[model samples]
Target: MTRLGNARLVLDNEIRPGGVVFAGGLIGDIGEIGPGGDGLDLEGDYLIPGIIDLHTDNLERQTQPRANARWPSRSALVAHDAQCIAAGITTVFDALCLGDIGFGKARNQTFEDAVIDIAALRRQGALRAEHFLHLRCELPAEEMPEMLARAIEDTHVRLVSLMDHTPGLSGQYGDLVRYREMRRAEGLAPAEVETVIAELQGNHHAFHAANRALVIAAARARFIPLASHDDATETEIARNAAEGIGITEFPVSLQAARAARARGMRSIAGAPNLVRGGSHSGNVAVIDLVRENLLDALASDYVPGAMLEAAFIAAAEGAIALPAAIGLITSGPAAIAGLADRGRIAPGLRADLVQVRLHEGLPVVRAVWRGGVRVG
Candidate 1:
């Protein structure tokens, strides 16, 4: 048995000085009382559940680190897995895009390569972190339903999100002019942006309605949890809730977040938005959602390490206590991801844990353990 003591155990509701014991890849004993058994000394660092990242685009970023560069898929998957483990994420749902509007055409390639890569790596025991797929289906893309159908037939798809990234929609990219700016920022020439925008602006009307129904039906048919992306209004939330979407991903306004709560759907906010204190795209502030009790979880939309940093940011801002804030990255996400065996510092659970040390008010990952084995 391996026992770790002299640590602040971050529990479901509070943090207490305690110790944890593990055997055979499961938590064995735990307590807030002082330790008596011979064990490793933690020096008062915090012991938290290994983070559960429900939505992360770290793999996309890994595959295309530069504007014009695309790395080999197998190599990129390995790198992405390592980055997730180092960030204290044990269960990583690599969010791969199913279809692209224009600028993110690389999504098609990523979607094709990642499933094969993950399966191959897992079979070889080459990956460090546990990996799953979160298929981000672009509802406006004409071929998205087909893409999802092909994806679910082969890969171990865990979660699916319905998205409409077409300009003039009700969500983040609604403004056509701002959308043009973003396309240019993605290394598209002005002429190319306009050509793409002209083709896409009114096309959403033709494809979105049918695509939404088809995608939702597909996900439900497989019993995978569904999330609605970038909801901006009560009507949108109501519509999505009616369609059986149980989670709202990054509502752009408090109205939408409140609507999500009223409809009994959990809300997942971007950790980068929370840590940056506001949305870079002018969406609802995550802190406001926290204050209003509209937030259920925090996801690392782009940056993996932001999960740990955002939890600390939430705690330091006094909006919530440390242990509660930590849940945004751990237990809250685990619950939504339908994982019940981990995400808590209790006995008879998977020993997936992270040791974090505070440095100048920011939490730094000191060590990470998955299934009672130190992996980082």
Candidate 2:
């Protein structure tokens, strides 16, 4: 048994200064402690639930820092897991892109292989943080259906997102000229870039229709949650809802976010958007979504530390109470991923907790516990 005391515990909808006890990987008790027990005092810092990261591409970036520069899968997974734990992320869904857009660093079968390798490592208990797969499927990819089918076969595949980044279709890849420049920077020949663009344009509609069917079918078959990424229009939200996607990730506009909420779907905005005060891609600001009561959760799209930082930012901005802000990184994401346990400071919940110390108005992780054991 482990007892953590002298901290403000962020529980459901409130923050209470109390001690939390854990035994056998579950929260045993939570209340005031008056000595006479083995306890580790946190000296009145904040003790919040271990962060749950729903969307992170850090693993993919670690695996392939540069184009064609592939690192060993096990090494990359270990490094990514360590970084997540150190950043207070107890649960992480590694976002792996599945697409044949003929652009970007990860645009081939190598990505699929990397996902498989990560799953294998997780099954072997080689990963420090609890890892799951978040397959980012490009709807315009011709082979996405087959890839989705294969990925769903893995029990670790917890979430799937349908993405459509075709130029002129979704504003996600906003400017085609910028896309062309990026491709050129990646060393794509002019002829090859034109051919790929033509191919993407030619098959955009058909691939979108086919991939949507595959995503819906896979979600049902695997009982995995489905999300629509970069929704820019109300029609897109309606279409996603019709296909049974209950999560809208990073809607490009307020209208799309409102439509998502109307359809009973959770609207997830990137934590980076909150920290940076705006979207890097010039999309909808997460603070605006929070103000409008349209935001349901915050995802660490690429920055693991942004989860906690965004929560504090939300609290400081009066967008939500401290506990509610913390929920955006904890219970909200756990529930979205169907993780019924953990994410709360209550008995019988998994003892996934983090001790945070504030430094210059930023939350820094002092310690992390996963399942009653001190992991970091």
Ten-residue region with minimum lDDT total, candidate 2: 102-111
Candidate 2: regions farther than 4 A off: 34-37, 104-110, 177-194
Candidate 1 stretches greater than 4 Å from native: 32-38
Judge candidate 2 at residue 200 and give its lDDT: 82
User: Measured by C-alpha RMSD in angstroms, how accurate is candidate 1?
Assistant: 1.5
Best model per lDDT: 1
Clashing pairs in 2: none
What does the lDDT read for residue 249 in candidate 2?
93
Q: What is the C-alpha lDDT profile of model 2 across 287-339, one tens digit per residue?
A: 98988889878888888889999999999999888898898889999889989
Candidate 1 backbone clash number: 0
Tell me the TM-score of model 1: 0.96
TM-score of each: 0.96, 0.94
Candidate number of the best TM-score:
1
